[model samples]
Target: MTAGEPDLVGPEILDGHLYDYPAYYDLVFGSDCAAETAFFEDCFRQLARRPVERIFEPACGTGRLLYRLSRRGYSVSGNDLNPHAVAYCNARFERAGWDPPAVLGDMADFRLRRKVDAAFNTINSFRHLDNENAARSHLGCVAAALARGGLYLLGLHLTPTRGPRDMGESWTARRGHLGIVSNLQSISIDRRRRVEKFAMSFDVYTPTRHRRIEGILEYRTYTLEQIRRSVESVPSLEWIETFDFAYDISRPVVVGNLTEDVVLVLRKR
Candidate 1:
């Protein structure tokens, strides 16, 4: 049940495109503004006021948040199920003069030897659970990690109302240093997978040439209602804030929707 190099996965990178988790993340999000992203993560930590002695990111691909938190004076540790990701994190930790937290099996249900003061799922990471039961199990996992009053912060998403949405795609580049891609992503749920599939057919082209270096990234989504229902089942779960991403409009967006996906700050009761 260990997650190490032999068990990790990276992009086969066949047919001119495709990478495993780290390659996929580097390609998709591009190496841009990592500090900015980390700032928000620290914001969550500050908001929760939890002394994050040991932190866990279930989907810590390439150690994005883990790396940032470590740089910022936190004793950070994490587990990424993808072997490629886990390997990358281990290397990063070694280079940083730290011992990488051993990655256990799947995020759906994992048990760490050490208890943590806080844990989080940021940037819609919680949507990976795919089904209701798995999400609930993970929520319980979070509760078990806490010390009676530990905090769990999640930047989750609500169900997107179906429509064209003027969804467009675009890509940008930065001379020879790096390339940037901003594209329209359409995410829809498949009842069979119980997971929302985000379809991206965009490419990051070389600077000035505008030739497409093929990048295909697909991430399945899970709904906020599913998260709420799951977390509620945990005996000591308590939800404090319900932040909205409504863009300051009159009412909420999307029909048949009753929940606002927010940075759910949960305290183990």
Candidate 2:
């Protein structure tokens, strides 16, 4: 770990499960690994004008996509603000006998010496930017780092029109002998300011013992229109199209009462 980067990966119950441990985080979401990677590959094939020999993943938590990209023979590089995530990714690559290019860096100011053919931020990770300016800066930096006419795939939920609503969901996954339950809830949403507050509770179960760790998170919400406007504000990026989580590019984006999330295909101008 670097000087200021955190070395802890969990067991600090109050700090939250995800912030503390990479293994629990992976177990909770790794079930969808195949689907997520397939979506990324599909987008690259459908949109990129040039072959995607290299990819850059910003806010790449746990290197899920990065690992998959490498497995498919694409050169992969990524960065995460969380030092734990960066360290975990590096270790993961090492275990697989592959060199890892993940590092600790802020998305707003991250830069690489070599430009990549494409970049992506998956699973609502981009919403971590709390405001429009921050979001724009992140996009601008990504655009500046990508090759000319290269593609950028961004995925996140679109704010609903029915005003702020509370929602909750839960799912279970296993890691070896341990079983984990991930419970997520939306505590509040500020429609006017486009911010949503949420919480996560992780329950870990062993045969004889059980533990719970919880944490809160906040995200800046974006509607479809706001997303288009934000991209417009980033001079080097052009909005190409939007697809829902299904990753079906043939169908046009339906931004309506029920639309909640989308993956936007953007090009570096």
Top candidate on lDDT is 2
lDDT of 1 by residue, 1-269 (tens): 11111313321222443225354455454444364345445545554545556677776667766777677776666666677777877787788788885374566788777777777766566666656677788888878877666677666656544532323345543435334344545555464565544444333333232222344344445455555567789978787654433212223234234443556667778
lDDT of each: 0.58, 0.81
Which candidate should be chosen as best, given TM-score against the real structure? 2
lDDT of 2 at 227: 79
What value does the lDDT take at residue 256 in candidate 1?
Answer: 31
Instruction: Give candidate 2 misplaced runs (Cα > 4 Å).
Output: 1-14, 162-166, 250-252
Error of 1 at 38 (Å): 6.2
TM-score of each: 0.70, 0.89
Q: Residue 239 of candidate 2: its Cα lDDT?
A: 84
At residue 147, give the lDDT of candidate 1.
67
lDDT of 2 by residue, 1-269 (tens): 11122334533254544855787777887887887788777777877877789999998878877898898999999988888888898999999999977998888888789999999886888898998889999999999999987899998888866665338678889866777778889988897988888898887766555666887889898876787799899888888877887766666595665578788888987
How far off is residue 35 in model 2, in Å? 1.3
